[model samples]
Target: MAKSNKKTKKADEDMSKKKAEESKVKVEAEISNDTADTEENSAKTSEVSVESLKSEIDQLNDKFLRLNAEYQNYRKRVEKEKNDIFKYGSEKLFVEMLPIMDNFERALSASEQENIESKVLDGIKMIKKSLDELFDRNGVKKIEAMGMPFDPIKHHAVMTVESEDENNDHVIEVFQDGYALNDKVIRPSMVKVSH
Candidate 1:
């Protein structure tokens, strides 16, 4: 009976040892699985952070380029405006001097029949020539209205005359010659149109 009891006790001890070995294997497997999961999660998080940073950098670069372009455009626009102001600043003064120039031309033309001395006539002619040269140099040109088709854009009709001719609707006479500066009309020609 004692031997049987000892044998049973030894069998029980062996079974317990096998159970402990199986439990240890299961615990090790769980630890390994947990470590792999942790490593995968850490890698995913790192990749996301890197992508987010790259996107932010790209957006900032785009903004910087746009701002630089805007600044360049603004600088160009200001420079162009400044040049224009400097070039055309005397436009109003030139326009105001046109009537005086026309009066001088009329006075010289009327004095052609006077019994003036030859020297005085020559001096007047020289002055008229100088005035004309000055006007030419300053880009001042006369608007030719005589015998040309009347255009409201360049001529102002102050009176109308009756005529049977087809071309009569155009300018019959120019009362006051117009002037232009640099191809732009400074004053419209005062004229008479025929109907």
Candidate 2:
């Protein structure tokens, strides 16, 4: 009977040992799973933060480039405007002097018929020639208006007259000659239009 009791006790001890080893294995497996989950979560969070930072940087870069381009375009436009202002700055003064030029031409024409002295006429001609050269050098040009079609932009109608000629609504005579500077009209021709 004593020997039989010893055998039963030994079987009970072996069973208890087997149960403890199984519990340890289960605990180890759970710990490993928990650690893996923590590492995966940390990696996912880092990836999200990195992606967010990259998106923000790209957006900022795009905005900077756009502003730089816009500012460059603005500067170019302002420079062109300034150049045009400089180029046409003298237009107003030249327009004011056109009437004096017309009077000079009239004076020369009258002198031609007045039987003026040779030396005086020569002096007037030289002055007129100098005036013409000045105009030519300054890009000032006379508008061709006489006997042509009347234009509202380049010609002002001072009088409308009846005509027997074939040209209708045309400039019959120029009362005042027009002038242009650099292809831009400084003054419109004062003219009589034929009906």
Specify the highest-TM-score model's number. Answer: 2
Per-residue lDDT tens digits for candidate 1, residues 1-195, read: 999999998888888888999999989988889889988989998899999999999999999999999999999999998976766666798887887778777777777657556776687778778877977887778899988988888899999989787886789898898887777788999999987
- TM-score per prediction, in order, is 0.63, 0.69
RMSD of every candidate to native, in Å, equals: 5.0, 4.7
Model 2 score (lDDT): 0.89
Report lDDT (CA) for all predictions.
0.85, 0.89
Model 2 CA lDDT for position 20: 85
- The reply for model 1, stretches above 4 Å from the true place, is 1-58, 112-121, 160-163
After TM-score superposition, the amount by which residue 6's alpha carbon in candidate 2 deviates from its true location, in angstroms, is 16
lDDT accuracy of residue 41 in candidate 1: 89
